[model samples]
Target: MRGVDVLSTAFKNAFRSRLRTSLTVLAIFIGAFTLSLTNGLGTGINQYIDDTVASVGVDDVMTVTKASEEEPTDGPAEYDPNQIAADGAPGATATALTDDDIDTIAGIDGVESVEPSKSVMVDYVRHDDGTRYQLSVAEFVPGMRIELVSGEQVDLDASDPELVLPESYVEPLDLGSAADAVGQTVVLAVTDATGEQVTTEATVVGVAEPGVLTMGGAVPNDVLAAELYDLQTTGAPEAETTRYAEASVSFDTSGGATQTEALQDRLADAGFTGSTLEDQLGTITAVIDGIVLVLNGFAVIALVAAGIGIVNTLFMAVQERTREVGLMKAMGLSSGRVFSLFSIEAVVIGLVGSALGVLGAVGAGQLVNGVSGDLLADLPGLTLIAFDPVGVATVVLGVMAIAFLAGTLPALRAARQDPISSLRYE
Candidate 1:
């Protein structure tokens, strides 16, 4: 028989035992549906992480800090006056990066430049007669990208002190709306040295959406941060004001990963620790991927069970069609052709079941995505379940391959039957 003729005949025969074939197909459907959903979950989360990494960090910049040589003891050790408050936060001290350390880092190979990291603390923010709300402001870094709800990102080079308000702060601060807050003035009060209150006013340049990097804090440009830092340190010793907990080092990006590692090694040799954005966020991605892998294991187990069902279904079909096989052999059909016929039937069943499963998964994923979009409305640009065409295709083809393999034994038994003996038995 021609290939087309054989394929058509096999498809027709596949549903002869309707209930049995349906049960076997249902098993395969369960496995395919599960596999597709798990893959979609992984794709969606990883995509969101990729976008967040791009928006939050710069690839060519590394955050460098002086590594603490003092080992941890059972109790607090004697305080060293040389150590400064880390990030300028009260009660937190660390080995501060001084002017000498900055010069040493600049002299290191492959470093383009270094900027002292500043941590600005704002006591409270008040707009007009609105209530005073405690506000945490994050320092701005060059080349940083932030997702904005309205207006534009803070400009570090701008002469005036500019700040971006977080979405959560708008209503509480009585800023009206995100758009209305732009270009408005807000007062920030900070306590200077000698325990005196100091107030600084900054214009709102933009409003930012809630994000991983912002951590519910306001974002301040260089001018705003420098102004706040200066106010907070007024009347303090000049030597103490210059001390910093860390620095931002910009490096050559053309060298890629090898160059990045070399620069980090050089920093380590200088008694400093340098970490790129990937180093800081790698643990998050690793944990996410690991969870997806575990979930996939369960789907694979279901597929294996489905494979066994395919084997049993084909074996029964072979037994029930023993006479038909003998009659076909009695005609001009060859053993190879008989084998091909049975294999095609198995493939046809796999195609039907897998197609339905993939379609069903797509439907379910869309529904979940819609529901999650509302539930996670605060997290813009996130899809909870997203399907990739290539991944879905891989699942369908994999299930069909398993079905073909399971039919092999049955096809072989039919091929080996002796025509004269099989025809006389019934």
Candidate 2:
């Protein structure tokens, strides 16, 4: 028989018992459905995380902090003046970053520059409507990620006090929308030496969207940072004023990921630890990936069960068609063609099952995502289950490959049947 004839015969033979074929296909469908859904879930979440991380962190710069050497005691030790202290946070056992540390960090190989972090204390910040809210500021260091809902990033070099507002603050600040908030003047209040509230005005430069990695805090320009530092420490002594919380170290990007990691390793060797945005969020990503992996493993288990179904189904088909196999071989059909015919039947079953399963998964995923939209409204641009064409195709091909492997033993048995004995059997 010709190749086309063999294929056509195999396809017809696949549905010789419609109910039997349907049951086997259903088994494959369950596995494919689970696999596609899990893959889509993983893709959607990881893609969102990648986008947010890119928006909020710089790859080439590392945030450096002093390493805490554990002075193990019988229990928690009381305030000892011998060790360094965190300046902004009271009673925190943090080693304050000094000028010498900056010099040494700057002297490290591959380091381009070092910017010391200064903690600003603003008593309160309010819009023109005089509604005051609690104040906190984040620094705009190299590689820091920020996405503006409207307006531009903070002008760090601007001589005047420029501030970026988080989206959550736009409404509370009595600013109607993010767009209208830009270019408006906001008043920041601080306590003076006499413990009186001193008000200062700053221009609103941008409105930023909150992200998983981006803290929902405002960013003040260098001018504002210095001003807030001065206002907060005006009454405090010089010893307290000289201390810094941490510093940012910028490294050359010419070398790539390995080089950047090496620089961080070198920093650790010097009694300091450096972390990029990826390093900071590594644990979070790892957890997400781990959950996805566990879910995928379950899907794979379903697939393995489906593979066994393929094996059993093909084995039974071969048994029922023994006489037909003998007759075809008697009619000059080669063993190779017989084997190809059975394998093609297996392929058709896989194709039908995988196609239906993918359609089902996509429909279910869409329904879930649609219902979840309102619940996840706070997290904009998030698609709960998103299917990638390449990933989908991979899933389909993967199932088909498994089916082919499962059909091998049965296909070989059918190919090796004896024509004289098989034709004489009842």
Candidate 3:
């Protein structure tokens, strides 16, 4: 029989056995749907990570201090920085990062700029009700220009006392707006080098952009410093500063991979430890990818089960058509023609089932997203699920291959049937 004729006959027979054909198609549909959902989720996670990294400006590298050197002791040693500082003792022999370190980092190859910062814990007085809040004072060095929504960036050269606060703090205190908070004076109490509580008044200067505070627990670093320093008669003495933070070097480069590797090497050479946004994002992406892979494996098993069902159904069809096959052979139909006819039916079943599966998955994805939107509305950096066409196409092709293999044994058996013996058996 011609290929088209064979396909037509196979489809006709498939519809004639409606119940079995429907069950077989349903099996394929379940397998395809599962595979597509997992694949689409994986893609969505990757895209979300990429978006977060891009929004945060991954070209910059950050450096933070590691634990201090300590002599070997018998019992488990406490390593908390807060506890050590509370004990009125310096925990580490390693020197705090200084202007010299910043200069050295800036001199490195591919280094575009460097910013040094220092943070100290202090007490803040709420302007409206005079409630106390623990705050960290941060100093911003020159060349680190953060995007500001209101007012101006910290003036590294100006000795005038100024402070900035995060927008998050404004709403909790019933501070009407960030713009109103600007130019208002707030008092900050800080412990001096001699452990004396000194209060300083600083004028609010500006508000940082929302993106700056989205990832890490960031605040107005320079503003807090100005507040604490202005309150004290003798501002925080440099020698007594406990913790120092720095943005040692930032590059004007692109491509997260190359920049991360180069920055890691530079940090290691400078006796510091740090991580880039790309590294953190990569860790998250790897975990999501592993989960997707495990789920896909389960989906593959489901598809295998469906394939077996297809084989069984085709075998039953062959048995029921034994006399018919024998008659066709007697009428000069070739074995190759019989095989082609059976294969065509399997392909058609697979294609139709895959189409249904794709439609179902897409609809389900949309429904899930709609329900999740309300729950995720308040979550920062949350991403919605989406469908991927490339993944759908891959799943369809895989299903078709499995279906064709399932039909192969039955087709071969029917092709080898003997006309004269078969006619006599029944």
Candidate 4:
């Protein structure tokens, strides 16, 4: 038979044994649906992480700290009575970075520069006719911008003493809403280095929404940071004034991954450790990816079981069609055409099963999202099962390939049957 004729005959023949073929197709459908749903789950979660990562921190910048110098000893090392600390610097007990450490970091090759993290020691924060509350303030780091509820973000490069208030702080400060809080000034009281109380004021330029990677507190412009740092250290001797909690390290990544790793390696060897934002989220992503992989394993086992079903059904079809195969051969049909005909039947089953499974999965995904969306209202931008067209197409093609492989043995058996022996048997 011609190829088209063989395909046409195969299509018609597939449904001749409706019950058996339907059972096999149903088996394949279950496997495909499971596999596609699992894939979509992975895709949705990873995509959400990627979106969060954009606000997590700057990819080119890494947080750095001095490697701890004290090694564990059986007993406390010989005390150095002469080990003196700068008069106003951080206490020896604290892991305080100093100007010298910053200088050392800047000296490293491939290092751009370092910005020391300024700790804003606020005694109390109070808004117009509102109760005073203790609050923590953080400087606006480049690339780690928070999602805005209203107004605009703090311009880190600008010298204005602008602050982005957190949503949680809105009601406490008597700010009715994000829009109402904008352009309002709040008073911040702190104890300067001279042990005297100092009060500073900053304008509320914006309000921030909650985010996974944000500080969850007030974000201040560079001017506020500089202002607070000066007040906290003013009148203290320079030797005691310049201390840092940690520092932001910037490096050139134009050298690509290899050079970026090399730079980090060099920093490590120099007694300083640096970690990019990805490093911070590495463990989280690893755990998520591992769970997704385990779920996918179960889906694949189902697909494998479906393949066996395909094999059994094709074998049964080959037996039932033996007389028909003999008759076709007797009419001058080539063995290759007979093989093609059986293979096409398997392909047809795969196509029907995959189409049903994929369409069903899409509908089920919508139902799951609708049911769970309100239950997970806090987790915005999350779709538990989300499909990618390419991923869905890949699953379909993979199932069809498995079906084609399963039918190979049956096709070969049908092609090898002797015409005279097969015709006389029945």
Tens-digit per-residue lDDT, 1-426, candidate 3 = 776788889889766788998999999899888887787778866876676567545446554443244555889875644222321246533335555656666777666765554444565546645567665543343344444557666565556666566556555545568787777766667776566787766666776554422321223445455455444424555543433444545665575567667766776676655555566567788999999999999988998998888888888888888888888999999989888777767877787777788788787877767776777644344445567778888889888898899889988888888988767657
Clash count for candidate 1 is 0
After superposing candidate 3 on the true structure, give the runs of residues whose Cα lies further than 4 Å from its correct spot.
60-104, 116-125, 130-170, 177-218, 221-248, 254-275, 380-383, 421-425
Off-target runs (Cα >4 Å) in candidate 4 are 54-57, 65-100, 118-140, 157-161, 185-202, 215-217, 222-246, 253-259, 278-286, 371-373, 424-426
* CA shift of 399, model 3, Å: 2.1
Point out where model 2 deviates above 4 Å.
1-5, 53-57, 67-96, 119-124, 128-131, 143-145, 188-201, 229-245, 281-283
TM-score winner between candidates 3 and 4: 4
List, residue by residue over 1-426, the lDDT tens digit for candidate 2. 788998898899889978988998999899899999998988888788777777664777788888776665798776644355553457666776778888988998988999888777677789875678997676667555467899888776789998888888888889888999999999988886557777788989999887654467788888888787788778776666666667888888789888998898899998788988787667667888798889888988998898888888989999998898999899998999989889888887887888889989999999989987888876777888889999899989998998898888889989999998889868
lDDT score, candidate 2, position 294? 95
Highest TM-score: which candidate? 1
Better of 1 and 3 by TM-score: 1
lDDT of 4 by residue, 335-389 (tens): 9998888888887888778778888888999998897788865566778788999
lDDT-sorted candidate list, best first: 1, 2, 4, 3
Query: For model 2, where is the 10-residue window of minimal lDDT?
Result: 80-89
Report the lDDT tens digits of candidate 1 across residue range 41-117: 98888888888988676898888888877886789877876687664357767788888999999999999999998
Score candidate 3 by TM-score against the native.
0.72
For candidate 3, the per-residue lDDT at 192 reads 68
List the lowest-lDDT window of 10 residues for candidate 3: 80-89
- Per-model TM against the reference: 0.83, 0.82, 0.72, 0.77
